[model samples]
Target: MVEFDLVAPRSADEAFAALRAAAPDGAAVLAGGTDLLPDVDEGRQRPRVVVSLRHLPWRTLDWAGPSLTIGSTLPLRALEQDPDLVRRFPGLAEAIRDVGSVALRHRATLGGNVVRAAPTSDLVPVLLALDAEVEIVGPRGTRRLPVDRFVRASRRVDLGPEELVRAVWFPEARPSAYRWQRVRPANDISQVAVAAACSPADRRWRIAVGGVAPRPVRIPSAAEALGAGAPTAAAVARAARAAADAVAFPTDRRASADYRRHLVATLVERVVDAVVRAEGFPR
Candidate 1:
């Protein structure tokens, strides 16, 4: 059996110190442990130490006017239950519901998902469409990066060894929708997911796709095809096709490249249409 030391720091400074001390030997950050625990049990990861963020004061959700901030350690279930969260960011709410079962979501966290940087993550695509930013705190101090820049690829992030994700920030609320195709709806991973949103401030649309290799990315060309608010059917089709052709889908055990391409196109169209209707755009 593999054995390792576990530490729960009471403060951010202590957390960083613990991480720094354990870095040479290898250390893994434990948030919700929804993913980390699985990796550890499956022998996919073997660290000398595991640093838990349980004692940190990061479980929070705050809204300032139109902007919102989600504390890193906050449980996904808590976020999903907030009525304002559902009303203000429906796509995000939909993605959160797709994460795992209720019991799993009770322990799963948004920060953990972002840090995991899984290409199949349901939340990241919505975050991309919402133009979210990640806040990080490290030995060098705190800094923020756009979600697009923060998530580099599958199981990879731009976080430093001694850094902790503090929170995720959204610039403003948006009318959005998220849709995905999966083997099972309850606790299975997505084969392909699409997130669509329109900025109330600018009336410009944002589109992003998940389940692609490397990472989930915002498709600027797809958004361009959408043009401004309440795109006509032709524009929506163009955007969907653009999204379908933009990404290089991976042929893995779960799905084929062609199947994913088709899913992306279909889901993109559905999500965009949903967002438009949700916003009460004229038919």
Candidate 2:
């Protein structure tokens, strides 16, 4: 592993300044370090200076009217068991539960996960499904970006040199449900992952698929197929097809593209069925 200097800032301003000092040359901001450590050790990433944000002031969760402001430093474990969060956004809570092991969850922060932007991130699909917004602090000032636009294929964002993920604000959903499934390859990462969410208030739903492409992605065409009017076997199949076609799955050691595509359809169906049952409704 490469050796680098570590800096811990007590406040956001100090952190921003430290980042600015190192920004022109590309500095890395460290959070819980769960995602960064592996890459650095494996030679996928190297940094001259690692600015640790764990001691910064971005660790509190606050309420904002119909929305809840989740701090960037808040751990996934806290998200998993927060009663208010569970009741208001069950889909998010469920997503948090599936992030990793209990110990990992206790130290994995939301900001870190989103910033990592891995294709298989457990929370990405659910956050995108809810049409959430991202909070970022950059040199220009803090700005809010939509969760969808925040996602890019290169696992990079528009964040400026002095920027860091500050928080995420999402409105309290009005009764929602979500479904998730993962096909774990025997000796590798997941072959495929499927997730879906439904909001009864608008009678609208979203379906997101991960682990089949370069990024955890949203399939607009397939989501449209799963309309709010009524559920049927035919509708399910059509939606599944769109969802599969929307992705450009590739053949990898985990699974062949064909296998992943087939599983995507099956998982989509399974999730849709589970969600319907969860809502005390029929397909």
Measured by TM-score, the strongest candidate is 1
Write down the TM-score of every candidate: 0.97, 0.89
lDDT of each: 0.92, 0.76
Alpha-carbon runs more than 4 Å astray in model 1 = 279-283
* Clashing residue pairs found in predicted model 1: none
Q: What TM-score, to 2 decimals, does candidate 2 have?
A: 0.89
RMSD of 2: 2.7
Candidate 2 residue spans exceeding 4 A from truth: 174-188, 278-283
Look at candidate 1 and tell me the lDDT of residue 209.
92
Candidate 1 residue lDDT tens string, 200-265? 888899999999998898999999998888898899899989998999999999999999998998
Please give the range of 10 consecutive residues that has the lowest summed lDDT in model 1: 274-283
Looking at candidate 2, the ten consecutive residues that score lowest on lDDT are 180-189
